[model samples]
Target: MLRLAALDGQVSSWLDLFGPIVFYLIVWGLVFAGTGLFVGVFIPFITGDSLLFAAGILSAGHSGINIWVLAIGVGIAAFLGDQVGFLLGRHYGRPYLDRRTGAWVQRSIRRAEKFYTDLGWWAVVVGRFIPWGRVLVPPIAGIARMDYLKFVAANLVGALVWGVLLTVTGYFAASIPAVKSAAYVIGGAFILGAIIAGILSWRRNRAAV
Candidate 1:
């Protein structure tokens, strides 16, 4: 009797009874939207790449929310989150940098200010793809007093592109069984890849210094 009650739980049965495709869309859509908002760019750096690849494969396999829609939703969320990050940088950036007495951050701000000055708007555009650069770029733009309109425009475009690319890659990865099986490996690789790329970029920029 107890076993039957446990087996008959409405929530479990409801989800279990639903079509797998619908389940995937609802699950991944929410995941994309929620994670996109709370975490922003970090999502891709973390579990985002694997999760997206999984979603893509599922979408390829069955009827689910259109991949384009998923991309747009996640993209918008990315835009909003980054906008918030930009605003935070614009308002609070100076105080945080000034109050914190870390040698690393100071060196970073010095380099960033120089970068922002020399490159003008491209710093925001290219920096979106860089790890710590993503966090630092917008604020640095604010600190350097780059044109508000230009900074916002670059940020919006970069965020949208970042969101869409990561989502699509996930979808593509899911399409291949071998790739799906290797998501754990791929996810780790993506993280390392981003880190390596960021370090290389930082070093190259430093060398140019």
Candidate 2:
């Protein structure tokens, strides 16, 4: 049985499905796969801005999820995720693109290319803020044969900043009465939506396989 999530609830519907600790772990995994997994190559919507925000808000309470852990873990996952994308770009970028089937992938490819060209190595960091760009820019950077060490440095800085800032912002928001309530509502909605999106992505990938 499932309960409808209340817009004003302090917690999310996902909390009902798992213990507080388990729920946080699930959030962590989703954050990881959303960017790190190859799934995003085909589906870019899996990025974790919403998840990170939601998780941060939840962590501010007695949610059993440490803010430090969430921030650091997500940062590492993001860095590694881009690494996978970059490697794919370096090794099988265009050839794979030629065989790829879908307008979404193509459009993302074009956007990622332009983004990388305009900003060069900076795209790797800037792309972290963009949904599709987060997933696509890394591979494009690799395709262009951007220096590996430079990419790593930029990638590290971007990941840490993104992870820390978003999570901390959410954490502090929980301290406010009006803002906390509103953020909880927003975060719950985003979590539920991300869960649905993740399920759809998994099913889509399986079908493609």
Candidate 3:
């Protein structure tokens, strides 16, 4: 009876020590996953890579979140987002590719279509790692009439790979003091790059006009 009581107390103590960490992981995981879905599907400007990297950094310490959970959450979000985009393309057809669509959106679709033509289903997997590729591939695939089953399979694999790679990279990189200190700088660089790309795109469109 004494031994049973002692074991129970130890279990309770351990839970007390770790409970908050577990709760934080769950809450943050859901939030990041939701963000992944939103950014993956709707916002071309926001990249999932950065989010995964941030999650990785958060997952580094003893009280940090579980890497696998973060990866899975983000992966699921990406997959669902891609699926929705695919369905949208399937239903809407190629009207979006015409002049009615914005230049940036059209460019993204064209690039993704070229990838699909060159590499077939492999393009879906490879495209997830690329910035515009991630946003454009699914809809292009749907418009191209690619098999839904095959698309889903490739999407899942790509999402999982992307999530794992970026998260793990961030997680390990955070361990380095220099990387940790410069994380903000790296984030700023991403934003700056996005701005530059947008400006260049706008200039190109004006020239074409």
Candidate 4:
């Protein structure tokens, strides 16, 4: 997305043309689609991580934007976006994918399937932090026929965490050093959380048996 943004200085030009509010409305839409929409299957390389981080930096000093509002609004968009993916998948997942024989399409489906198989419900949350992972988890979960209640719980937690963490880090990156490191920490936390959840689940199953 950043690369796409840099083309002919479009992002800069948009900020100049639309100012903050309208510009961010566009950002929220992109984030929603990139992370939560099934059409994201085609545009999986979107620079949402960088986009959110940059938005946070702008929110720090950019008048007319509040970090909390940005975080919550984007989070809600992300959550609803996943709902769309899940619903679509529940109704037409495999058939839809069968129609898509593009190389990227197949590869993305395989990777998303791997994540869903390996992580189960946690994939929905951890995938939010991983690119391509976020794009497909929703539909993947639906195709797997996961419980809707479980999917919603994981989606809400993932979106809120992703929204606040990146936005806040970017806000501080406006003044602080190691903004890059903060991103690493966020990614690490998601992977580690998935691992821990897996371990606990294994233990619980063993105990029940």
Candidate 5:
């Protein structure tokens, strides 16, 4: 029991040292760099979800940062990213698609086209929950020439939902003593979720084939 108590104390100390710095970086990234990176056609290595989760854990402490502010900032950043991606796709996507010469490129285009045709606005909302899908769907919508007004409506709703869901989840999870101590459990779960998502995607592709 004493050993467990000591270990817990150690974990809390480490969290104290690094958590604030991580929180600051996450806030900065969400407000600035995250927007640009998420807007790109190529999916980035780091995603907004993990950052938001960390932000939640930090907020669980005496940190003065407001959760609402973080959510709003992240929402705005994501909205802008989607807008920029849409614009880029509107301007360059078709020309790039036309000039490209590869089966993979063509397949991706077809999938996007199908997503638009089958799901329409819901595609935008659903894509927001997916990592690569979130990155690719906005541009795909632009490529398909989806109506700008409809896209904006969907984008707003999607960003709001995504931002709130992630931030709040983290905040609540961190409030639990058991959860705070085993913080790595959260990260592990995220990784497992990603792996599961990948497997499902792979199975979907194989079934389609």
Candidate 6:
């Protein structure tokens, strides 16, 4: 059953049968033990957006993993990961960030803290789409000492939406012919522009200082 669905022996029949479930188990195990957050942050940077999108494509297939189930799994993984991150920040990371007192860290943390406060738990939801926002925001929530339940609830919703959206986008992207290339070109251009703008901002700030 699993073999027929995945069509790849390397992925394993059990994986096809309970692969995603297994994945959730392993991912959460790491999170509970406090390593999964590292995986989540760097996986995006290393694999780029394609992997999450691929997961979506997998979910969309006639295979065992449906979109809703995938969404729930990913959501649970992300929430648990962030919860660990929040705990880490509350216990360890936040103290370092707070003590460093460097202007940039201060600025970043202040902005994040302010957002967390003003928006309450919803900031975690909005932060899901923000790249680096996801990385910093949970820690901010922890440092800010926001209600854990509220944070968890918001994190669950945000991760579900973001996970589903990215996967669905990947599905549609694969479906289109020219759109993939176009998306690459557009995304590349946007990144280049952001880099250039960041450089200019740095130079100007340097000059001012």
Best TM-score among the predictions, by candidate number = 4
The ten-residue window of minimal lDDT in model 3 covers 30-39
Go through the candidates in order and give each one's C-alpha lDDT.
0.54, 0.68, 0.61, 0.75, 0.62, 0.56
lDDT of 4 by residue, 160-206 (tens): 88866776777787788587587778679777978689667756777
Cα error of candidate 2 at position 59, Å: 1.0
Q: Candidate 6 on 182-205: residue-level lDDT in tens?
A: 655754564455445545655676
Task: Give the per-residue lDDT digits (tens) of candidate 1, residues 1-209.
Answer: 35323432431343456855555444444433432333323333332333444444445544544777666665665555556656666777688556645676567667767755555555665555555455556666776666778777876766565556656655666545465446446545654554465566666787998
**Ordering by TM-score:** 4, 2, 5, 3, 6, 1
Q: Residue-wise lDDT of candidate 2 within 13-50, one digit each (tens)? A: 56666767776566666656655665656534334555
Positional deviation of residue 115's Cα in model 4 after best superposition, in angstroms: 1.4
Any residue pairs clashing in model 3, and if so which? none
lDDT: which candidate is best?
Answer: 4
Question: Candidate 2: TM-score?
Answer: 0.72
Each prediction's TM-score versus the true structure: 0.54, 0.72, 0.61, 0.85, 0.63, 0.55
lDDT for model 3 comes to 0.61
Question: Which scores greater on TM-score, model 1 or model 3?
Answer: 3
Candidate 3 residue 147 Cα shift, in angstroms, is 1.0
Q: Tell me the spans in candidate 4 whose CA falls farther than 4 Å from its real position.
A: 1-10, 45-47, 199-209
lDDT of 5: 0.62
Q: What is the lDDT of residue 148 in candidate 1?
A: 77
What's the CA error at residue 141 for candidate 1, in Å? 1.3
Query: Tens-digit lDDT track for model 3 on 34-149?
Result: 32333444443234555555556656753646767666666766777678767767888777445336676667667778766656666677666677777767777889899999
